[model samples]
Target: MQCAYCTEKAVMNTPPRCKNHFVELFEKTAHETIKEFNLIQEGQTLCVAASGGKDSLALLEVLHTQYPVEALCVDEGIAGYRDTSIRDLQAYCTEKSIPLRIVSFADLGSKSLDELNPTHPCSTCGVLRRKALLQYSTKYDLIATGHNLDDEAQTILMNILRNQRQLLSRIGPKTPAQQGIAARIKPFYLIPEKEIRAYCLLKQITTNFSECPNVVKSFRWRVGEELNELERKQPGTKKNIVTAFLNKHYVREEHKRCEQHFCRRCGMPASNELCRACTLITIGS
Candidate 1:
């Protein structure tokens, strides 16, 4: 097939674009998302919540072009998986001369995620990882994440399926800063996951392609699979879901109703007396 914009052979099927055009589209989408949401402000410190995956690394690569960015990684201590990814992350950061900070479950005085033995591994790890990010990223003005369109769509559907109204309300391209938590931004909010992988290849960014060992067992994995299937059958299904959710008045109203309190144990933002991370850690202990 030929490229939509040029006679060069196409490399991506989504838009029938050649290598150069696909790369252009991917970076343009990310930059537009940031500008549309005002995700980054001038003279503000930015730290990317990188996981050494294609998505995060791709985000880091694009953002670095415009801003002085640092990388903050959370090690869930998932033995073979996280260790390999972190190695790739370290190498990339070193080559780029970007500052990198890594915090592990052990650093939080909890067992590694592999050793946590929780009923829901993803849920347990997510809470702890979020806490680790927020806890250690206080110095930064914003914490950027690599949540793409696919991830955002899956999260929206998952929250709706589980009737997690509060979480659904919190969904967006950027989250405002609360009392104790730093604001978070998602510059790749409109980019597809496939484009991110392709961008990494084109940019020669190093990333581990392995999936987390525990992902297959999570509710999100199931939801993501279903969403992918739907997206396959119906192009733009994921985008429509995110767009509708974002424009819905109910989500905005729900977000206003959502209240935040400090966890008694860690003094971080929480809805209850103890933050989700502290509660999960206590349960695991």
Candidate 2:
């Protein structure tokens, strides 16, 4: 049978069956969440974090279809791997005429990805990227990520498992509206990983299929794979978890109070003695 929202006359024999139908679902949820969170106001400039991966590419496409978006790309100095991804990201952004800014791990510090703590290069990369993006404070009204439903669910479960209730509370579609920090929003917060991959396939977006080679050894990867398997065994599990997170738990305006002071080490905003970025860098160094 043909998909509900597909313009194509041909049909694929996949379960849940509709290729374009999921796009519509994704777009609807995206728009609704954007509206509900007031994530973007008219004439606002938004920055999208494009990792040259499927989820991020799809996010760029969807956002381009709706609002004005600029892209921020961070090259983690992963040797050839990062260069290739950066070229792909820049090419795609150039095609859409979306302004792109490139930052390098070397610029952030002399350290390369391999030079960091072997156990967690991702945390370092994330911190540096955040610091770089924040430097572009003038151009962006909001910051967006490609994190989908699966990511949110995984993070929530992981936080709960670690008994980090405070951190878990902030993992939502709309991160709390904190002052001085650019409001971060995830339009694809309700989307599933499989559906996002499908949309990328249908739209022919270029993406790196290989998981981040560095993170493969991490505990998070194991948890992520377990979650993926569980998702296959049970549909809507991610959505259900996210819904419960929203309904049963509410993130108060008080959550903002945590980062009221600036990190003494890095001068970035922070609640404790150090910002996450500074903490990671210091620990790694």
lDDT top scorer:
1
**Number of the predicted model whose TM-score against the real structure is largest:** 1
Residues 148-253 of candidate 2 have per-residue lDDT tens digits of: 8888888878877887655753577766434455777888888777778878888777876666777776656777888877878996677898888777534454
Model 1: per-residue Cα lDDT over 170-245, one tens digit each:
5899788877577899998888888888899888887878799889999999999999999989999999999998
Q: RMSD of each candidate? A: 1.2, 2.8
Model 2 clash tally, residue pairs: 0
> Which regions of candidate 1 deviate over 4 angstroms?
none
Q: Worst 10-residue stretch by lDDT in candidate 2?
A: 8-17
Name the runs in model 2 displaced over 4 angstroms.
1-22, 177-179, 282-285
Instruction: Give the range where candidate 1 is weakest over 10 consecutive residues by summed lDDT.
Output: 252-261
TM-score of each: 0.97, 0.87
